[model samples]
Target: MNTRIGTIFAQEFRLARRNLWVGLATGILGLFAVVLGVFGAGQGAALDADALTLTAASLATLSVYLIPLIALLMSYDSFAGEIERGALALTLASPVRRWEIFVGKFAAQSLAVGVAILLAFGAAGAFLALSFGTGSEGIAAWMRLMATAFVLGSVFVGFGLMLSAMAGRTATAAASAVGLWLVLVVIYDLALLGSVMAASDGIFASQVFPWLVVANPADAFRLFNLALIETAPVAGIDGLASTLPFPPTVALAVLGLWLSAVLALGIRRTKRIVP
Candidate 1:
């Protein structure tokens, strides 16, 4: 909010506008939105509750992968790349506080990705409205889906920024970001599946499964969006929805905690950057 942070934030957006990766990420999200919209409209199903449910499910499933990956890519270089190229040092030498730099960069990257999500999903919504007479419920559901995707993307941007701050070089930061993505997005689920199978009908599985799913931001995102639907696109987790400790609101709070915790850590770590 201060002049220094505002300047840094504006500078980040200006630089991001020219970044090829930002353009590519935005284009990919837009492409997915258009494709999904066209495919759903082509189904020619009446715009009823079931139709809205189906569309929500489809978008949630797609977003679980797309939003987080794009956010991670956009933020992986936030500090590492700047540090590698000496821009961070130059900026620190000025009157700016390190926290200002970190917060400014984080806010800028989040806004960029958030805007992309809005435009992409907005386009889809427009198409859907044109194809099927707009209804209040349908529009509300789409809006919820869009909001959830943006929050989910912000969580991963925090993750990427944390890695960028901790890693000493861009390559290391990028590698760490990709590895975290694999663990959270892919390997974690596989491991969870194995754990569930091994602990089948045991007290540990019954007591621990819900917490495990909630602990992972990706699973939380999926659960929060798919909570209303009877079936979930993610395998092996649908059955526990009824018994989960918290509701979608809690999952969203957990994601908020993720964004705050990681970004705070990143800011703290970034202050220690030498030269």
Candidate 2:
């Protein structure tokens, strides 16, 4: 909230707004929200507690993929693209410290994506609540989803900026961003499954599997959100989540670690940038 940081935030937020990525993301989330609400309601069954839990499960799954992708795209070019266009050099010539620059830009990007998510989810949740009488618990669950989803976006914004700081070109940063998304959001769980299954000793699956899931931010995000739901979307994952050796709090802590480590590294790399 420093003056200089605020200025940078306003400037970057305008850029994101002008680019229409925010609008696009909001539209996508809103579309899915409507689909989920309408189809579930059309079945002639009022969405009681159990039905609402399934809906929560679905939203949690959607957040796992979409939020990270939105955040990464917003941030992957933060430094590298600016540097590529020589704006970073001019910004570097200013009196602001590297940390301030990263914080300002990341804050703006997070705010943009966070607003879009809340708007879409809020509208959808309200519609479902009014239409189906989801009651207090369902409202609270949606609120929780909004909170965790906000943090999840911050986690990936840090990731994208970290990669942005390290890459010399926007192309490299973009590629790295997408690959990181794929690895963490998609491939990590699959690889972990393979490792657990192949472990002849069975100790890995029993003792180490949960920890491994914690190490991946995407999995950690999913675990934290799903731990509260009775019927998780995936059969195998829900079984693990049921007796999830550690509570949802552990996954939340690991996500915090991810954000801190990446932000620190981003600042470190920013200090090294000649621009």
Best-matching candidate per lDDT: 2
Give the 10-residue window scoring lowest on summed lDDT in candidate 2: 42-51
Instruction: Give one digit per residue, the lDDT tens place, for model 2 in 153-243.
Output: 9889989998999996999999999999999988987888888778899677778888888778877777887888654445665457776
* TM per prediction: 0.91, 0.93
The candidate maximizing TM-score is 2
lDDT of each: 0.79, 0.82
Per residue, candidate 1 scores C-alpha lDDT tens digits across 1-275 of 99998998998887777786567766787787667766765453543343444566678777878888898988898888988899888898898998988888888888888888888787767776776555666676678888988888888988888899889689999999999999998898889878888875777677787778878888788777777565333346655655666776778888888888888898898888885
Model 1 off-target regions past 4 Å? 40-52, 230-235
Give, for candidate 1, the lowest lDDT window spanning 10 residues.
44-53
| TM accuracy, model 1 | 0.91
Instruction: State the TM-score for model 2.
Output: 0.93
